[model samples]
Target: MFGKLYLIPVDLGHPSFEALFPTLNREITSTLTHFVVENQKSARRSLKLIFPEIKQGELSLLTLDKNTSELDLNPALDWLKSGKNVGVVSEAGVPSIADPGSLMVKLAHAQNIEVIPLIGPCSIFLALSASGLSGQSFVFHGYIPIDKAEKTRFIKEMEKATGRNQAQIFMETPYRNNQMLEDLLSVCKEDTLLCIACDLTLPNQYIKTQTIGKWKKLKTEDLHKRPCIFILGN
Candidate 1:
């Protein structure tokens, strides 16, 4: 029998994993010896936190990021075929959702390998749950375009989609968060509602929904360098 692939989720900047993840998640993650991760350092650090007694050298890790080649992932599948369960974890939040682990999961399905997703906090879902927007019909545009003209066009389109009762969600790099917010306020209508979920699941977390006009007047000092999720709604 082939071993299963476990989709593990990590905390989103929370001081302790216990705060966002259940004990069962930690238990399952600790038992796995093989893992495919986005960043080796963060992955190893997370594993050490979950299993304090784990020997760093004993754990096998495979890097899977935007640059990882399809051919390079074959080794992970080989491990699973050899009856060794492999875990997939991202830098934060759940794997394969707006992350690079989807390729591995897709391959697992093709090879008839069982893929099991363990429960944990996902920032996107967490933001949507508290946004008070149209949860039934929503779209998540991973990241906005970097070009000024393209970003403006994208924002306007999302606003139009939101007007039709569909929530439009997106994110940006932490350092560029302020720039994204500026473009949002400048391009979106004054009355359009926008939700900003920042530092999710962390000690200094902040989530608020307000009109673009209202947001324009407030100082966004806190969101300057924080990871955030932005949701646009009517």
Candidate 2:
């Protein structure tokens, strides 16, 4: 077997998070020589909260701020050179998917490092599971366009995909949830189903499923600031 380079997902710390925590702690204590995080401060806070018993000195945390497309993973590269196992984590959700850790994963693969992933709660999966959409085939578009014209074009394409029975999953920044919903309501047909999976695994969590036309009638301000996963099916 090869040395492990664990790709741990620490998004909202869902219920499954508690179960995965001790396993992560044990792995860190036993095999982790270094950690690569998107944000050092948050990583430290999370570590202190979840694995307070683990000594700080045993882990070397490297903070990465570059976009996955622009990321220069020299720090992670150097860590692996020392024959020490390195772990990559994002602030939320699985790292590398709509997150910056993809670059590191790509580099690690090229360098022949064994990349191991731990199963945990993912808002996307949770959303899809409850969306009542076809799961056998789907596409995660990551994010929709910010520009009106671009977004319109994107929605048209998404409609085409879903109309043929493929589930479409996408996300947006928390504050823009309402606008995204509005755009979807305007572009999608009345029969199109929309699933808004917000703040999964957190208190006051919400999963609302409705047709595009019906969703427009609901007030947006009522929805709190939440990490959300949006799904559309035709």
Candidate 3:
């Protein structure tokens, strides 16, 4: 008997949850046994929302702490030892990219467990599709710097990458998003095209593509305080 590992990435809060719940339930019915959630609270909250009929014996929900890098993989290690199926989930988006689940994934792979990643929404792809940039060649720079000097350096690097016709994508925490935008507008050339994909796949989802010149005149106060993906091109 082979054990299983499901990598479930939750994009939006409700809709993504709704879409994944049914599929996850079917897996449970088929003998899935362990779930590795970002945290205990998130695990319980998601289970209650998706599968209220969760049983104590059929599943083991391991809640990893916020400092995921420091999290001990002993639980997951033990589960693999028992030949039990394990599922990995992130708070939002796919697990392992920007989440702590990658560590577990590496460990599981070393043990030769079956790792299957389920289909789900990813902001990076969504932004790339709508950005009108070079999809064939793009680099996800992940989160950018918060400090002024570091942020400037990062932007310069991104501009250089974009000059090579590669779509450069990065994200910033919501509260600092506007400031980041301001910095981009100030530094990027007027003709530099930028795409801001906000609240993707949600009711208030916004995808706008424009040059630095155009964004400078737009009123940013109106944008909702939700996380957004920023894409830029030459």
On lDDT, the leading prediction is 1
Q: Which prediction has more favorable TM-score, 1 or 3?
A: 1
Identify the superior model by lDDT, candidate 1 or candidate 3.
Answer: 1
Point out where model 2 deviates above 4 Å.
Answer: 13-30, 67-72, 217-221
For all candidates in order, the CA lDDT equals 0.90, 0.75, 0.76
Summarize candidate 1's per-residue lDDT along 1-234 as a digit string, tens digits. 999999988878775867777888878877889999999999888777666777789989999999998798999999999999999989988998888899999999999999999888899999999999999999999998999999999999999999789999999998899888888988999999999999989888899999999999998656778999999998
TM-score of 3: 0.87
Using TM-score, give the best candidate's number: 1
Candidate order by lDDT, decreasing, is 1, 3, 2
lDDT of 1 at 11: 73
TM-scores, all models, native as reference: 0.96, 0.86, 0.87
lDDT of 2 by residue, 1-234 (tens): 344578776747544436445466445634565888898877665555555565677678877656434345676777776677777777776677777687777778887888887655567887899888879999999877899999999998998898789999999888888778778888899878888888787776788788877787777534435788888886
lDDT, residue 194, candidate 2: 87
The 10 consecutive residues of candidate 2 with the worst lDDT sum are 13-22
Name the regions of candidate 1 deviating beyond 4 angstroms.
Answer: none
